[model samples]
Target: MIFVNILISFIVIIILQLLGMVILSKMTPFNDMEELNKGNVAVGLVFGGQFLGTAIILGVAAYTNSSIWYMALWFAVGYVCLLLSYWIFDWLTPGIKLSDQLKDGNKAVALLLACVYIGIGFAVSSLII
Candidate 1:
């Protein structure tokens, strides 16, 4: 029962994070996955930033002052794990220079990437948790 509860809760977190990324992507002017995949710095930063942001949100939610918070805590745990996955991906994907472009002030690309990062983190975390 405990494992089932954890699994369901983790799945919920992944879905919510994906939903959030989709919404965030739509809000931005640019929506090019190809461009985003081409090592755009903006995308990388957003990817990294969104995970960090989601982790914090989840962390706070874990405090469990309310039903919403309790649910959020489960998501938070999954998200942190997801963030670790990102670090692993970065370490593994050597020579992928997205950081340079991010420093060049590219908002559209960044927003797009933020979505991807969060999406990946959410997915990975959901699976493991």
Candidate 2:
């Protein structure tokens, strides 16, 4: 029963996070998937942003009165959430423009993309916990 609860909770959190990311992507002006697939430095920034965002949010969730099951489940769900966010972004903005910008080493655009991912990730994680 405990394992089942953990799995269900994890799935719920992942779905919620994915939904949040979709909403965020529409609101943001940047997309990171284009750069990531093209093997650019922007990928590093995106990863960094995602890592920090997930760490802080999951860390906080792990704290407080959350059970061990909740913490572990949230952490696992967060990773799936991140990937879903990227997939959703690609689907929503299928144009090649973002890739073009990254190819030219546009730091501003890269930063914007990273910020969006981190912001959304953090926001969704907080809501779940």
Candidate 3:
């Protein structure tokens, strides 16, 4: 029974992570996989940060919630918060369009945005009771 429960949790987490990635890909103007294939380091870093951020949130959610439904709910909340942080970062940096800069292969912008996402992930994870 314990093994089955663990397996289910693992599968659920993987599904949620893939869903998050899909949503993120839709949100961005450029194709992430294509850019990654083109050896765009900036896109790779930003995507890496997103993956790590979601994983952190999912980890906390799975650890804290006993019910699968509750875990999914909390994961959704964390995912929204993670998405909002990107918009907030854009808002904070006036007159600079983050998505545009990222599409243009700006390494500095990507690095800062990646840091913002990861930093927000850490902060949000701490709040996930």
Candidate 4:
């Protein structure tokens, strides 16, 4: 049963990560893969953060929950929180559009956002148990 739970978690986590990527891509106006392929460091930073953030949440959820379904449920909560943090940060900052700055390769904004995502992941993970 433990092995089965682990296997299910592995599959579900991968699916969740893909879903997060899709949602993120839809949020931005530019093509995510195109930017990454073009060697855009700003996009790389933010995108990397998004990936790591979800990973952190998933790991914590899996660790805390005994059942696979419960783990996925907790993951959903953390994932929603993470997404909210992203949108809230963007909304709070006026004058400049983060998506545009990212496309233009603004490392400063990218770095800040990356840290935000990572930080939120850790913060949310702590509350999981």
Candidate 5:
């Protein structure tokens, strides 16, 4: 029974992560996989940060909740927070458009945005408890 529960949890988490990525891809103007294929480090960094951020929240949600439904609910909350953080970052920088900078291959902008995503993820993960 324990093994089965663990397997189910693993599968659910993977599905949630994929769903998060799909949603993120839709939110962005550029194609993430295509940029990644073109060796765009800026896109890679931001996408990696987004993946890690969502993973952090999913980890917390899985750790704190035994029920899959509750885990899913928390995951949803965490995902929304991550998305909002990106929007907030854009709002904070009124003079520059982050997506445009990223598309232009600005490594510095990518690094800062990645950091912001990870930082907010850590903060939001703490609240999952």
Candidate 6:
């Protein structure tokens, strides 16, 4: 059933994105949801960045694969690359922990990180085809 495939893909993508966010939360020094509840714009920017990045990759995965399983598998691959990009970003920054800065509500770092994530997402997605 085509509708069933669509439903499965939708569910799988939702789960994968949530899992990616959960893993990112674990890597952070603060609770993202709590910060959002506290009106932390910096945290909001970073989350938006990561979400955009993952969405781009997911879009590409879905476009390139006909089978739902292949789509899900490729999405997982892209998601892993997204996670690695964050770590690489952390290592690349000079003498500052990116996550800590975000927790401290640094808007500049948050914006920069967000832009970097978006750019990386585009870059990674471009490679998927």
Q: Give me the candidate number with maximum TM-score.
A: 5
Estimate candidate 3's RMSD in Å: 1.4
Please tell me which model should have the higher TM-score, number 1 or number 3: 3
Poorest 10 consecutive residues by lDDT, candidate 2: 19-28
Clashing residue pairs for model 4: none
TM-score of every candidate:
0.50, 0.54, 0.90, 0.90, 0.92, 0.88
Q: Provide the lDDT at 1 for model 2.
A: 92
User: Model 2 segments beyond 4 Å from truth?
Assistant: 1-40, 97-106
Tens-place lDDT digits, model 3, residues 6-104: 999989888988998888878788888888889888887788888788788778877887678877887788789878988888899998888788778
Model 5 C-alpha lDDT per residue in residues 62-104, reported as the tens digit of each score: 8888888878887788889888988898899998798888888
Of candidates 5 and 3, the better by lDDT: 5
- How displaced is residue 28 in candidate 1, in Å? 1.6
Residue 122, model 3: lDDT of 77
Judge candidate 6 at residue 89 and give its lDDT.
85
lDDT of 3 at 113: 79
Q: Give one digit per residue, the lDDT tens place, for model 2 in 1-129.
A: 978856765675566445544553453365645545676676556556766666655666655434756755665676567667666665676763554555566676567667766776687677673
lDDT by residue for model 4 (1-129), tens? 768867877898899889888888778899988998999999999988988888898888887776667767766777788789878998999877889999999999999998898898899888887
Q: Summarize candidate 6's per-residue lDDT along 1-129 as a digit string, tens digits.
A: 889988988898889778878877887878988988998899899888888888888888788877667666766776677678778888998787988888889999888888887887788888876
Question: Measured by TM-score, how close is model 3 to the native structure?
Answer: 0.90
| Clash pairs for candidate 3 | none
Question: How many clashes in candidate 2?
Answer: 0
Model 5 alpha-carbon drift over 4 Å, by segment: none
